[model samples]
Target: MTKLISQYTALLDKLDRLDWLVPTLARLSFLAVLFFYFWNSATLKIDGSIFSPSAGAFGQIFPKAAEAVLYDVTQLNIFQRLVIFGGTVAEFVLPVLIVIGLMTRVAALAMIGFVMVQTLVDVTGHGVALGSLFDSAQGLIDQRVMWILLFAILVFKGAGPVSLDALLRKRAT
Candidate 1:
């Protein structure tokens, strides 16, 4: 029994040495799953130019308000416009920062907040069902929670060794 325990400990210790792969794989997973998801959404928000948001942007971001204004984006208040613009920009920018491993923790943290807001918008604005945790596999809450967990991994572990953050840290030192 003691020899078996020793062998198990040695095997676990070997696996522990690959800790760097955790963050790297987390970033890769973000790139693969979420990067383009956000990119495409951002594209839909823009109309003629990147600076100009489409009618769909207002409808998506502020559903009731957009309906109130009849989807005329120009009718939205400055603050509302700013929010839509900022959200659109973040959707495009945050994922790139995470994938490139630049300002990773901050980016991931922001992504967590973004996911929370997105979930709220889906629930409140779009009427998506907010299912209870562990209740079922399908719902805005469960899906967004998983996305937030992925971002949390980056928040805690950072971009790992193969990242620009790591390179800059090495250079600065």
Candidate 2:
């Protein structure tokens, strides 16, 4: 029994050495699962240029306020428009950074913040349910948590050897 235990421990140690796979897989998964989702969303927010956000963009970011003004984005304050613009830009920029593994940790960290804000907007602005955690795993909260965890992996582990970050580090060294 002791010999069997030792063998199991050794195997587990070997598996642990593959820790680099975590961030690499996380980035790839983000590319596969969410890259286009954000790109498409950002596209929807723009009518012609990012300087001119669509009425739908205001509705999405500030739904109640947009409805209060009947979805006329011009009725919103400068700060509000800036928020919408910043969010739209982030939705495009952060995902690309993560996908390319450039400035990955910072990008992932920003993505976590973005997801949190997006979740808030989804729940409050859009009237989406904030569904309780551990209840059944079908709520916006659960889904966003998983997304955040994927970003968190990139935040902590970094984009692995396959990344532009890795290449830059090598060049610098």
Candidate 3:
């Protein structure tokens, strides 16, 4: 039994030495599952031209605010436009940064925030009901919570040796 315990400990240490594993897995998970959702949503916001977001995107992000602005998204003030456009750009940019392991920590942190904001938007924009977190089945929060956990792994462990962040660190050294 002691020999078995020693072998298992060795195996665990070996896995830990593969420092890039967690970050890489997190990146792959996001790429495989969530990338298209973000890309498709961002595509909808754009008008097939640079930085040109549709009114619908604004409405989606800021439903109450959009209503307050009376649906004339084009007539939105500068700050409002900036927020919508920035959010759109972030949806496109941050994921790529995370996948490539460039500024991965910042990207992961931003993505965590993004997930939170997205949940709020889903509740407010689409009027999704807040369900009990202890419920037997999954809810919107449950799905988003899983996403947050994945992002958190990348945030804490970083992109690892296979990533650009690691490459840059090596170069610096």
Candidate 4:
């Protein structure tokens, strides 16, 4: 039992020596973005109007123009709701997988798909004219671009050195 404990301790020490900051940061950022997206999705009232009613009411007193981004009322279906729930859950779960370095590619791919669908919805449903080089659609474009880049990095890099995936791969070989 003592020997087994010692071996496990030694293994942990070796793992601690591995540089995990970069991957961990990436995973953490991913989680943060997911949280933001989920919060916005759950809170934002979609009323099929250019200006959100809630925002308009708030704007009257605040004197600041609310970012009343519009979405398609028709697209808000049961399946889409399920997708949003799934994506939110995935956002919460995938980061843990990424931090541990288990099935990193799969988690990254899932996130990528989630972001892509969101981007598509934003483009098609919202009045964001496609391929417009103007600053009018800058915010939407920037958000989508960032997600694309982040997912691409995760896909290409997998989890960093300190992940469980690395250990498993080492064991398999």
Query: How well does model 3 score by local distance difference test?
Result: 0.84
Candidate 2 lowest-lDDT run of ten = 131-140
When sorted by TM-score, best at the front, the candidate numbers are 1, 2, 3, 4
**lDDT (Cα atoms) of all candidates against the true structure:** 0.90, 0.91, 0.84, 0.59
**Once all C-alphas are superposed, what RMSD does model 1 give against the true structure?**
1.3
Highest lDDT: give the candidate number: 2
Evaluate candidate 4 by giving its C-alpha RMSD to the native, one decimal: 12.1
Candidate order by lDDT, highest to lowest? 2, 1, 3, 4
Compose the digit string of candidate 4's lDDT tens values, residues 6-125: 999999898877646556567667667654564455334323432222332222212222223233333344554444445445655665676566898887787777667666655655
The TM-scores, one per candidate, come to 0.95, 0.94, 0.87, 0.53
- Looking at model 2, residue 87 earns an lDDT score of 91
What lDDT score goes with residue 96 in model 2? 94
Question: Compared to the true structure, candidate 1 yields what TM-score?
Answer: 0.95
Over the full model, what C-alpha lDDT does candidate 2 score relative to the true structure?
A: 0.91
Q: Where is model 4 more than 4 Å wrong at Cα?
A: 1-25, 28-85, 133-138
- Report the candidate with higher lDDT, 1 versus 3: 1
Tens digits of per-residue lDDT for model 2 on 1-173?
Answer: 99999999999999899989888999999999999999999999998999998999989998889999999978989988899899999999999999999999999999999999998988777766776765745566887889999999999999999999999999999
Question: Which 10 residues in a row give candidate 3 its minimum summed lDDT?
Answer: 129-138
Q: Candidate 1 — which residues are off by over 4 angstroms?
A: none
Which run of 10 residues does model 1 get worst, by summed lDDT?
A: 131-140
Instruction: Find the 10 residues in a row with the least total lDDT in model 4.
Output: 56-65
Error of 2 at 78 (Å): 0.7
